[model samples]
Target: MRKIIFLSLILIGLGVLLSFRPDRKPLSFPSSRVLPASKKDLQYKTHSVKQSVVHTLLIPASSRFLVTPTLSPELSSLESFVQKHQAIAAINGGFFDPENRKSTSYVMLQGVWVADPKDNKRLMNNLKLRPYLKKILNRTEFRRYRCGQTVRYDITLHSEPSPTGCQLLDALGGGPRVLPELTSVQEGFVDFAKGKVIRDPLGSSQPNARSAIGITSDGSLLVVMVAQKPEAPSNSGLSLPALADFMKTQGVEKAMNLDGGSSSCFYYKGKTVYGKINQQGNQVRRELFSVLVIR
Candidate 1:
């Protein structure tokens, strides 16, 4: 009888001990050969264009790019955007009205329209007149097609209307195509396209901190941010044409310029990788409306 009672107490004590133990996350074992850390694969380099400085980042093909929209209407800095999304790297995305701090271009998050046109008239007026845009804009069937699972890095430029342009915005839902810049490759480089290197028409000589996105020959996405050093002279950023030339050297077949100048920002691994100095003699870290985050 004593033995039976002792065994029951022992069993109850064991059960109580097991219940008090803390939960643990499953351990991940490396398969066969251990792989190198992902951070080791990311290449960081600095290049000089005359007096200006260019900071380039080469991300491997395995990485994924996502467009993170503002959860609130208020503008937030690049650091806040990265933390909110838990991104490995990020750059400012598409244009936004400074007053309202909302994306001026169409933005879709996870197959849902975060920003869309209200009335048909507004939708029709926002339609891009270029041939490529007209086809998708005029067709009612293609208006609501899902272009991709996430937002594309490229923007549909209402500034320079072209028939052969990104239909991503329309695919999400009808919205304005008014962006200052579009795919730079499609815009064409007179010097580079002609197998020569001359200053581009878009003021390649005027140096300013720049931000751009591109696709490599092997289909890897490239996000670039160029900024002037805080202590460097005022003449310390890449010209648009110089930026294009640099992109060509990087094997980028297609590319686009994002908001540059004071808006240029690059965040990587929980830190601001690159940022420009503003005219106010302060390092610029302006609040962003949207950002392209890497996961």
Candidate 2:
């Protein structure tokens, strides 16, 4: 009888101890897989927040990045780009119009304009978009500059000139720079006055699947894709501001939002993850006009 009573008391004590134990689930940083994979120079991580899962690929400076458009006239899937390049990792890039099958975002490869929005008839000829044309044309982009053996990555407006003596190796247009401050109004993603939003083309304030790229303080390239979490009360994904905040928390210094919504995706090590999921819980796969790949 004494042994049974002692065991019961011990079990009660353990229950009390377990109840007071601190929960580690709410940490902002990813709690798992911090180290690089075997024989790989890049690190792929998945961080979960309230209503979204952010997929991140961190690539060191030694690895090369290539931003290019699909060779075929039609847009290509993220998997196709990865397979074609035999890339270490890849993320969808730029923006495009499906109706006309023309790129709305600029794409420069090998210092030449591979995909130019100026050539998009619908965009240039639209009377409604005439007022915002200039800003849209000069949206932020991811660029690479090379001087001698030194190569650098940057997130800047399309109009920003490359550093003198440095060749513009590649560039992939996306937009409204998120870090160093969000450029929603300047980039034409939003129109606001008196603290009230008058127009928002990209639904800047709403939660939705988003893709963004940035350069960490250490100069590492960070590609991120925010996916919807269906089980959560709000499974829409992260808003532009939320994404910017998350990136800043992750040590991203300069960042730019990519073509998100249904277009957001990431591919690495023979696996692909889509960002947007429909109300019926189906993944929305979009063919992209361009992609940024690491090799």
| Local error of candidate 2 at residue 6 (angstroms) | 60
- After superposition of all CA atoms, the RMSD between model 1 and the true structure is 12.0
Off by over 4 Å in 1: 1-40, 63-72, 116-205, 231-233
Candidate 2 lDDT tens digits, 1-295: 9999999999999988877778824336764587545432677889986588899987876654543334334878888888888886888888888888899988888878888899999999999899899988999999888887888889898889988889998888888899989988888458778989999988788899999999988788888999997654245699888999999988999999998999989888889999988877878898877888877
Which digits, one per residue and each the tens of the lDDT, describe model 1 over residues 129-201?
A: 2323343232111121223443233333333332343333432211112122332333322235477555343
Query: Candidate 1, after superposition: displacement of residue 217 in Å?
Result: 1.1
Q: Please report the TM-score between candidate 1 and the true structure.
A: 0.58
